[model samples]
Target: MSFASYHDNIELGDTVILYLSPTELEAITIKRGGVERNKFGDFPHANMIGKPFGSKIYAMNKRSWIMALYPTPELWTRALPHRTQIIYSTDISLVAMYLNLKPGSVVIESGTGSASLSHAIIRTVAPTGHLHTFEYHEQRAQLARQDFEAHGLSHLVTVRCRDACKEGFGLERVADAVFLDLPSPWDAVESATRALKGPGAKLCSFSPCLEQVQKTCTRLRALGYQDIITYVGLIRHLSFSHTKMQNFVIRPNPKGTNSNKRTAEQSEATDGDAQSVQPSAKRENIEAEDEETQASETAVVGNPGVKWAPIEFATEFMTGRPAPSVRHARPHGIFDLCDTPMLSYCFRGDGLIVQNDQ
Candidate 1:
């Protein structure tokens, strides 16, 4: 059967360890249908190739047993030979979240570091997106490449042996996310920005010291990026048991009693409409009175008790009166009086007298 088919048929319990060749001891390749010699004993792949992946294979002669399949980050961390320090799962999970890395996001990671982080990124951005990782150390890069091939992720990742900081190599197109795991991540900020798509692109760095974070933050700001925040991850496991459930005897306090009372009162208040009617009515009456008083105080005519001034008089003074004076000053006379004089003729004993004024 093909190696790919062989890997597929192996069930959970089958024992398998990727064996390293003599020349490439750093690289671990899947050893099937062959005799694997170790200090403990000789493990024949013929016995294990047909079994399930997790099958417990015990060599009674050697008195050893190993469970198989691809190694998880935790198992790989403990087992993988490392030239540089590997990133822990805690940091890896946080980085993934902050970057918003999905299956199709092209990710650029620096310093493969036993390929622990690389392996995780591959799993996260699988099938669709590709991960291009750079490692300065040749041996480390080679080991990471081998691990990728063994895990069937060789097509998904490209491990380049180049000094990413000095040369800034292997950073081609704009990546959706960039993860820097080097000792001096600030040195790679320029390259990271060049590799990112735009302001939407995300870059995260892992540093153990506060000084490193300060330096990285400065570089990030200089690159015109916003919403930069640095925080440490802390995970604490709580011990829970039926016997240890919180009891009133353990935490006796007035605060707890008050909280319980408040909750009960709120629940009762929401149960029926009768208890809510009085409060709602009182609220409406208070609001209505406040509005009425405000309206009275702002009336157009003066209110002696409430101290309101006439709106018309205020508008006249503020806007200034019209320049042309009226013929009649009184309000009624201005409308009733006519500007032209009235002519009248009267006969005084056969003589005619005409008067222009009326």
Candidate 2:
């Protein structure tokens, strides 16, 4: 299968992702007679020539190896330069699908930060479509242009170094969709309306704050845009691991009284009778008990040394039954390790959509 835009055998100047490891990847272009040197080893460019993508090449020392794979949009986004905050795939995928992008869609984008998403857009709107992207920052615009040319996508994209907020975009009723990722997106609402080809042309703006979304929505509706709706898009990754169950014998509370405590003779008698019950009867009893509990903050075992301490547990603790727990580093910790990102981030994707009146 095709990785990104690459479909033929690897040759000169084809960008590839050097998969050193799962987390360790380096984006590079395959150049003849060129060599890629890393701490692991030196990878020769000529060696990759004529080799189909997805080829694995081990270093001469055999101690290190890397996989040469196609640069899909997902991989490109992850490997792009973090010059500024770029849209994550959670929002990108939604917008692309929501806009109904295909092989002939025309798109307008403002504030092309890092042009990370632009690549995906071009990929979706290529072979006949066009993307007119406006970037306020001259340096950023120039860099984006370079990126398009480098990826051989310049024919499909037009990067303009003009401010869509103050000066307004230079297009008029020629865009199938408009995407704004600006700090003050409200200021460009009028411009977006003017850029749309007709009623039903999709308009989307990405903002980082609720205040921005509210302001943008107001501007969009006031500018005669119909059917405005807003939403925050989010993406979550779930993982599963083997959990080792640690049996914790229940312990008596310090303030236990006769009403709450069960006598050993009584408990033994009750247990004997419970064991005699049918399996279905036991399952029903256990399920009934699970329905009554909520959260947990402490785990006290029968051992005297183990005092009543808050036991960090997942939301599954509501079952009241202690199951084998697979410890997690916490969502906050995961966010932190991924560059101290916000856990509940709502990329201004779903926030507002102006109904295209046909």
lDDT of each: 0.60, 0.69
- Candidate 2, residues 331-358: lDDT per residue as tens digits? 2112111121111111132321122223
lDDT of 1: 0.60
**What is candidate 1's lDDT per residue for 181-211, written digit by digit as tens?**
8878989989888888876889898898999
Model 1's C-alpha root-mean-square deviation from the true structure amounts to: 31.0
TM-score of each: 0.57, 0.67
Q: Once model 2 is optimally superposed onto the true structure by TM-score, how far is the C-alpha of residue 260 displaced, in angstroms?
A: 22
Residue 121 C-alpha lDDT in model 1: 83
The reply for model 2, stretches above 4 Å from the true place, is: 1-4, 242-358
Report the Cα lDDT for residue 224, model 1: 88
Off by over 4 Å in 1: 1-8, 11-43, 61-65, 170-173, 237-358
